[model samples]
Target: MELSEYCALDATALRELIRTGQVNAAEVETAARQAIESVNGDLNALTQPLFQSALDHDPDGPIGGVPFLVKDSGPFARGVTFTLGSRSIRGAVAAVDHELMTRFRAAGLATLGQTTAPELGLSYATESLRYGRTRNPWALERGVGGSSGGAAALVAAGAVPLAHGNDGGGSVRIPASACGLVGLKVSRGRTPSGPLAGEAGFGLIAEFGLTRSIRDTALLLECVSGPAVGEKYTLSSPDVRYTEVLRADPGRLRVAVTTDAWSGVPVDLQVAGVAAEAARTLEWIGHSVSPATPGIQPDDIVEGSMLAAVATGAALLRAPVRPDPGRLEAVSRALLAETLAFTALDVMAALDAQNRLTRAVGTFFTEYDLLVTPTLAQLPARHGELDYDDPGYSMRDWLRRIYQYGPFTAAFNVSGNPAISLPLGQSREGLPIGVQLVAATGREDLLLQVAAQLEQAQPWAGRQPSVFAG
Candidate 1:
């Protein structure tokens, strides 16, 4: 297959072609490599190239032969450098595959290489001193949202069809919104996290990926989802596969719509308008849409998220190979110091607050089937818009800035509910505008059904980025 033809197919379509012998795995891998070489220089998406290693993947595995990129943060493959977008761990290599990585390989995905992430996956924008900035494929001057920014950029640019990403406070969905892709963060414990750390971001982080098509996301979710042994929280398996769920209709439902940022930050008019428009679309599809938000305070979410993040950060800093203070980013160092100062009582208080908020949001979901909101408070920010290195920056200032950009997303992370960002509209400048559809915890099936409905109603497949290979 030609590079153009290869780039055009999503993971599901590519898998079908390989299954039918219409195209061989090697041909597809070659097409992916050529596509990456064509655009990665300008985009700076892939931080490493594992072309030879990818070629060694099992060709007969399910969805086998599809080129995939793993974010450099946490998805580890044995022998591959696992830089968490920090200079401290530059030469570090994973001795074993992460559980998610093992599953990805087992499902027949060829690990092409690692993509860039913000240092320690702390920031919402993928601009790290370690690997430089990952620019959006639609506009070079704009930032691709992070910590899944590099993966989103590669997929948006057509360098790859699907790429691994994990979300703790909007890491996956933020970039998916910026890049015009499907990004789903599953309910907590729906996927495994083991053999390295028990849970990431104190259970706020969920492992997943960004894809151009909803079916690709569904197929991957089906492939990698399941509880590992001794998992603290185990969710019951879905009665039907997500791949089959896409064809089913989500009955007319009650959806709460909110343009207001939970943080009380003034949302950009255009962004809010787009989200409101999406609500109208849902109404047209026979769902009851109303302007209602969860009865939780923005301050509670901010505090809870910071508490979890700081604790997680402190734990990570305690790794066997201690990082040099000078080598760490200014914000990372500052946050680490701040977290180190936190007392046990303070940590417990934060956890208590998070649990309360989670329960409150859960209660709200009992009244509504889903919640609709602007995935972002505004359009994608310009490169260097959010400063993480300034010594004067406080945790509060940082939260305010990030929440302004991604107010709707972090709450779901805190609540451990299933949320997805769908590219439903575009700004006047032509940047993608994504609207989020959030379902109660363990309701990915409902979210996917609604998402597939939206995808069919307004398809984004024809939209191409400025840096696309085709």
Candidate 2:
């Protein structure tokens, strides 16, 4: 298959082609490898390319024979180097496949390699001492939102149709907005979290993927979603297939639109206008739309997210793969120091804050079926702007900076609500602007329904970045 042909086909389209022998698996895989080679140098995507594994992958799963990239910071594949974008931990490899990784294999995805993430996924930008900045394809000088930055760039640039990424404090959605992709942070308890442990980041982390289209997003969810054995979370899969859900009407949804950040962070007017326009479009679609903001304190999210970082950092440090202090970056050193300083009671208070915010946001959802906000507060920032190496910051400070840049996203992450970022608008500079649609917990089915409708109403297929797979 030609690179242009491979890039043009989405996961669903490519699967059908291979399934019918119109295209062979190897041909698609080769195209993907070449695509990566063609763009990886400029985008700094793909931490490691495991293209050889494409040969032996199972060919009998839904969406099978599709090229996929896993985030370097997550869902460890057995024997693959699970560098959390850190220079430390020499020779550390995943001893077992995470439940998600197993599901990825079972779903017939050819794991091409790992994409870049921020060190420990702490920052909202994918720049670290381990792997340098992952540049946005939209504009080469801009940053790809982290820590799923590289995955988003790859998918956005059409190197692959879909790539695995997880969100805890907007990692997936942030990058999605920045890269103009479909990113969904599944609700808490909706996916697996065990085998090595029972839970993650005190239920803030939601493992999912990013894609170029809503149909691909819906299809991928059907392929890899569902709880595994001993997993901490267990939500029912879409009652019907998500692709089927996409076919139906979303039906008279009451949507709340907010240009004002609940965290009191500033939202750029251009980004806010795009969100406002999305609200208007929803109203035009026969849905009720109104301006509203969740009643919550900024500290609730900042504190809760920082505490989760503290917990995740503590766990990683205590594990056998602990990094040598000398090998750690300044930001990481500051993170560890901050983690050591935190008292257990402070963590309890953080949990209390999480509970309070979750309850407050959940209360807001009672009146509104959906919440629309800018997926990012500003446009994709220039590269080197979200500096991770600065030792002057603690985890809380870092959280504040990143969250302020994307105030709306973390609230949903902490609330455990399902949120999707769609590329619905473009800036005057031609950069894609993402509008986030958030649904109550475990409402991914509804998210897809509305997302598909929006995708149909205002198609983004005609737009491509300055740098694309072709």
Candidate 3:
């Protein structure tokens, strides 16, 4: 098959082709290389190519012969270099495959390359002083959201059907929304973060993928969703496959739509309108939608978490990854310095606050099965729009910038719930607008159910960016 023809098929379809003997793993890999050569000049998404490794060993499973990519950050890929979007760690190679990569191999998905991430995935956009920037497939003028920006871009451009993405604070979903794909942030510990380090963002986050289709997302989750050895936490898998849930109808359930941010920031009108449109679609599909507010108390949760995150961010300055002095951007360095200024007591206080916030969200889910809201308060940001180049800014100001752009996502990290950003609508300006679907802790089944229904109703798979459509 031609490169464009291979890129056009979803992972499932590709697998079917391979199983039916119509295509082979070598052909799929060739197609991926050709696709990358054709599309990556405009996107700058792939950080390291693994075509040789994939060709050397092709396993058989659910996604066998399907080409894919992993985010440059999080865990380790054996023999492949992982820069994590920083110049500091350039040329570093993984000594062993992370457990999730092991699962990807078992599933028969060929990981032909690594995708771009923000420097250390510290911020929400994929622009890095180290690697330049990852441009959105929809518009070169705008950024693809970081730190999974590369994965989102490749999937959006049809270079590959699914790619690895991990969300600490909306990294996966942010890029997914910005580039128009399905990004799922699995419940913390629901997906293993091991074979190198145990947890990241102090267990406030989890890893998964940004996929062009919900079924691809579901299949990827199945392949890599269980806990690995030495993990402190693990969630029970559903009795039936998540793809099975997609095949069944998502019966009427209570759905809540909220446009208000916990920090009192107003959602952009276009984003809110997109969420409303999704709500109407749910109603048309036999689900109930009503205005709902989170049950959590709003007294300093966002601020407190930001302060705590500062301490965690500070710890990364001394991280074991190959240090790329002068490789990271000034914003990351400034943020790290700010985190270092905090006392150990401050971090403890933040963890306590995180517990309280978790309890509050847990209480809310008792009444509502899902919460629907704008994935981002604003549309995709311009390149360097959230840059912290000003030396005069305080850590508090930096935190404000981060929180203002990503208020709703971090809360779910603390709560350790599964939430997804679905590219259900587009802004009048032609930017993608992702609507969030959040589920209770360990209840990904319900979340997938809702996603499958919405996916069918709106059908984002057929919608492609102009670059790829041609």
Candidate that would win on lDDT = 1
Q: What local distance difference test score does each model get?
A: 0.87, 0.86, 0.77
Q: Write the per-residue lDDT of candidate 2 for residues 1-470, one digit (tens) a residue.
A: 98999998789999999999998988998899999889898998877655466523567888788999888864388877777888885577778888877888888999888899988888788887777888899999899898899999999999999998989899999999998888999889877776676878888888889998889888878877887777777887866988899898878999988888877778899999998988898899999998887897999988778756886778766886567877887778888887788888988899899999999999998999999989999999887788888878877888888877888888777788999999999999999899999999889999999998889888998788988988
| CA shift of 44, model 2, Å | 1.0
Model 3 lDDT vs. the true structure?
0.77
**Stretches > 4 Å off in candidate 2:** none
Residue 301 deviation, candidate 2, in Å? Answer: 0.4
Error of 2 at 434 (Å): 0.5
2 or 3, greater by lDDT? 2
Q: Model 3: which residue pairs collide?
A: 64-108, 88-324
Q: Over the stretch 406-468, how does candidate 1's per-residue lDDT look in tens digits? A: 988888888899999999989999999999999999999999999998998888999998899
TM-score of each: 0.98, 0.98, 0.93
